[model samples]
Target: MFFADNLKFLRTRKEKSQTAMAEELELKRTSLIGYEKGVQPTFGVVMKLADYFKVSIDALLRYDLSKLGKFELSQIEQGFDVDITGKKLRLLVTTTDTNGEENIEMIRHQAQAGYTQGYNDPEYIESLPKFQLPFLSRNKTYRCFQIKGDSMPPLSDGSWVTASFIQDWNTIKNGTPCVVITKEDGIVFKLVYNQIKENQEIMLVSSNRSYAPYNVSIDDLAEVWKFETYNAFEV
Candidate 1:
């Protein structure tokens, strides 16, 4: 019913005693009991519980206590939040590195069609190529995509661009390079602007300058991955 009920539910569901949970959370048994009995935990302790329980803070605080092991909550805890629009999207697919760390998935040109409709489908996303880069931040979620044309030249075709996943659209900085995935435009590499922030639209600008910039509604926007780094090859 509340955070206490949620915490106690997860602990008892795991068959762990208050003392054991306290030991695991590095809190005293009495403190654990207090937490279970409606005593609010500090932000630090809340974070500890969320991590130890392998669930999101939102789930720990708001989700049904009965659904302790649901995939969505577990996925959120694992740092896999896919915020694609057009539908209520949540991707649970993750590929692990040799060290058992999850890597970002790379969307190939051929998969663009399926990606448009099945981006939210775990089966679809899981089938994409996934790899890790040593330069990538472990805490941030990322993805690699290869551009199709010279729209953003002289980067050219087949150049691999890696971008960090952006969940909040408002945080999108104006004039920043990004890979904008939408229903109308499957995927386009362009400079993004928040000029239409109040209208829930983004202005897409091309580097070639010959192409005029246009605005797209956020509802049509599927995924916006902000450019981080790119790998280019010379002939």
Candidate 2:
């Protein structure tokens, strides 16, 4: 099914108003209206809708659309494998302009510590809940850093967030927060948006009600990482 048709069908099956879906997706109702009216949902936005409807992108776009319901989709969306072995840590990072292909710059543990110390003297790494490195190869790079500021309160405190970097922005849906690195500031995590300008003035948004929105030019950005999860060792 076409994206719009799929969207319309899913909403009806769930018996949800466009306003309700928009609110649940954290989007303006107008945007959802546009989507149903044949406006192409951005890659990010499509993911959000798929997540809300609880279906995979393939299921949303190409699968037997008639067989799925919102509740079933929600389960599929939320179902994730917990790495009990703790060998792999899922870290989200943003993309670089490497000719449209994605690239990530590795920030080592010691370098990460430098950025962390700049924010506070908390032994951020050691204090984190310990999980075995989930791999036999010690040389494999698993941890990555995200620079944070007061913008995202309570969850992030302007410190570098360490996680494994995975480059799959297209699959990453909109309204999901990510860590973007700019030339001026090493890295900042915020919601991804499509507001682009001639000079690449991309909007860096926040989901937290207390925070305000801001714009960042492409010249300002060094990298962007889609955040997966965080490792905050209990203090």
Q: TM-score winner among the candidates?
A: 1
What value does the lDDT take at residue 83 in candidate 1?
A: 29
Candidate 1 lDDT score at position 211: 81
- Model 2, stretches more than 4 Å misplaced? 1-142, 146-148, 158-172, 196-199
Q: Which RMSD values do the candidates have, in order?
A: 12.3, 16.8
> Which candidate has the top score in lDDT?
1
Give the least accurate 10-residue stretch of model 2, judged by summed lDDT: 81-90
Model 1, 205-233: lDDT tens digits are 98988889999876678788899998663
Error of 1 at 103 (Å): 1.4
Task: Measure candidate 2: CA RMSD.
Answer: 16.8
lDDT, candidate 1, residue 15? 96
Query: What TM-scores do the predictions have?
Result: 0.59, 0.36
